[model samples]
Each structure stands twice: as C-alpha cells, then as structure tokens.
Target: MELALSVLQLAVRILALPVYVLHFLGLWSWICKKWFPHFLSRFTVMYNEQMAGRKRELFSNLQEFAGPSGKLSLLEVGCGTGANFKFYPSGCTVTCVDPNPNFEKFLFKSIAESRHLQFERFVVAAGEDMHQVADGSVDVVVCTLVLCSVESPEQILREVLRVLRPGGAFYFMEHVAADRSTWNYFWQQVLDPVWYLVFDGCNLTRKSWKVLEQAGFSKLKLQHIQAPLSWALVRPHIYGHAVK
Candidate 1:
C-alpha cells in the first residue's frame, strides 16, 4: 500500500508540473490574492458561526495581556481578509501581516466594520520572514488556518516567538493530518498535490501539532477537534495557545 501510494503521488506531481510552473511564475498568487479573499470572507461567516464557542474560549484571556495603554498589542500573521477580527477582545491594537499585498483593502474593510478593535498597520511579508515587525513587540500573536500552508511552520513559529514579549501568548487554530490508521489519511496523502495547487500551497496532510510541540514554547495547551467544514479533508483540527 505504501509503495502504491508513493507511485500515485509521484504521478500526480508529474502531471501537476505545469501548474506548479504557473505558481512559480506567480499566476496563482495573483489569482489568490485578488479573488480568494472574497470567497473566504463568505466562508468565514459560516466557519466563525460554527467555531464561535472555541474561539471565544481561546481568546478569553486577551484582556489579561493589556499593557499600560489599557490595550493589548496583537499581531496576526497570515491575517487573510482579517477574518479573525470579530473574535478579538475590544481595545486590541492589531497589526496584520500577510504575504499578499492585495489583502490590504479587504483588511481595512474588516477594520472599518470592527469598530471595537484598532488597526495599527498591515505589513506585506511572509509569516516565516517578518523582519518588518520588531522583535518582542507584541503581547499576543494569533494564527488560524495558516500553518498548513506556510513554507515552514517551524520558521513561522520562531518568528512568532521572536515577536512576542516574554510571558506573551500565541494562539493558533489549524487543520491537521488525520490519524494514519484512518482511511482519511490515505485520501489526504493522495489528494495533497492537487489540493496544494488549487488552494495556494495548502497541504492536506500536515501534522501541524508536532511542529507546535517542538516550537520551544514555555507552556503549551493543545487539543484536537473536528471542525464543521464542508470539506472532509480539512475537518480534523487542532487549536490552543502557547506562552513565550
């Protein structure tokens, strides 16, 4: 079975070489930045509704991180369409970072609607390399549905740790690989190449929790749950917080 799966995966990758070249030429990036956010904004509404309780629980401690200004300094990496803005505590001063410059307009639109939260600035940079953000400058760092797609989850976590102040928190929610014993795992491996092409580098079979565990956080609390996503491939999820 393993050999057969590897053969299939190789065949898929060979067939996908052309599309991969287009991605290399930035065609997919242009399409994703220009159009993906609109579709994601609609999907976020339903996703947020389904995961509201979990999100509220995750962000319940944001007020504890408030600085002398009586506001939490929060950084959100991969802040696509600013979808997590509504879940944040009021009075949070947010800095958004994303590789896609096109998300700025939509991010500002979300900022306008989220009157309770204050927008600091939007930085166009990848999560793994955010030199634009100063080190140890944020009280909190939030990431959702981002790890599976980043080129290096470990590097991103390192940057997350570097940006967070001592005793600061890092909150994350990510869809992860299903159990190896399950049929879902088999399908995930088979579909990963095509899914990565269509969804702009999102892998269907990343065990993101392992990266988080090895990220060198001082304290970590994580749990696995099934998100109410229409796509079965991305239903398995992990969410929790880590302290730097």
Candidate 2:
C-alpha cells in the first residue's frame, strides 16, 4: 500500500510535467491564457446567474469575508481571465499572473472602467515562483478557482503567505474535497486520470484548506458546499478568506 501510494503521488507529478511544458507553447498558451478562460468564465458567470441557488449562495457566503476596499493592493496568482476583479473597485489595483505569456497586452493591461478600477500588469509565471513582487508588499492576495490547476497547492499557499504582509489576508475560492465523504475518494480516483488532460492538471479532490492550515495560515473563514455535480463530478467547492 505504501508503495502504491508513492507511485500514485509520483504519477500525479509526472502527469503535470507535460502540462507545464504545454504552458510554454504560444499556440496552446493562447488557448489556456485566453480562449479557455473566455469560455469558462462565461459558463461560470452564467451558472452563477442562471442557477441562482447553492452555487450563488456559496459565492455570497464567501464574499462576506472579503476585506473592505479602499485602493487595496491586490495580487491574483492565477488571474487567467481576470473575471472576479470585475467586482472590485478600480481603486483596488491587481497584479495578475499566469503561465501563458502570449496573452494580448490589453488583456493584461490594467484598466479602470470606473475611477475605483485599477489594473496593473499581467505576468507570465506559475505559482511556484512570484519573485517579481517583494515580500509583504501586497495588502491582500487572492486566487480564485485556481488552486486545483496549480502544480503544488501546498507550496503555492506558502508562497502566497510569504508575499503577503503580516495581518494581510488571503482570499481564495476553489473546489476542494468533501470531508469524510466517499465522494472525496471517489472523485479523486475516478477523475485523477482524465482531469490532467481536460483541465491542465487541475485535480478534483485536493484538500487545500487542510493544506493551508498546516502551512500556518490561521483565522480561516471558509464555506464548503456540495454543488450539484455537473462540470466536475463528485467534487465539493470552498471559498474563504484567511490570514497569514
């Protein structure tokens, strides 16, 4: 069993290498960096609006913990399509990054549709590195629906904490495993193979909140919801805010 577990873990890493490689190809980068995001964001926004039930409730619940705004300096680690920033005041400037570098300049350029809106730049990098920004420089760090797609969520969370100032908050929203439910194991087991191909190594059963707690971020306010499984099967979703 131990050997099997080790192999399972190694397999996950091995599969991710190709995804990482694909991130560099300009053609595919156009897909992940631009196209997929455009479609997925639309689908998600539509779901949030048309469904108008538990999923939206989940977003609302997570919104409660978001810090009040006043030109807050924000960092979004995997700001694929820059969707959630639509809700923030333009004053809350965001430094967004992604692995795909081919994104159009305007897609990344900071724009203020409103006086409160301020966007800075879109960078081409992954979660394992955010060295461009100095530590503790940001007022708040956000990553929404991105943890699963990252290579090492545990490491990424640590990086997020490292970059955030003391007393700064990390506001994230992602799908995680349902505690103690057979669905948790079932989701990972069933989807682990195909998910790599479909979603750029995004896993369905990462227990990221537990990973965050272990990484020393405390005062977590999180909501776990079991959405009617459709897009990703047997998966549970979480949205929360935490402090480093």
Which number leads on lDDT?
1
Cα-based TM-score, every candidate: 0.91, 0.72
Candidate 1 lDDT by residue in tens digits, 1-244: 9998899888888888877787889787777667777777787888888888988888888888766677799999999888899889887899999998777788888999999998999999999999999999999999999999999999999999999999899999999999999888888998898788777789889999999999999999999998877878888999999999
Backbone clash count, each prediction separately? 0, 6
**Model 1 ranges off by over 4 Å:** 3-26
The candidate scoring highest on TM-score is 1
Instruction: Compose the digit string of candidate 2's lDDT tens values, residues 78-167.
Output: 776555655554346678877755433434432433345566767688877988888987877878778877888888887898888787
RMSDs, each prediction?
Answer: 2.2, 5.9
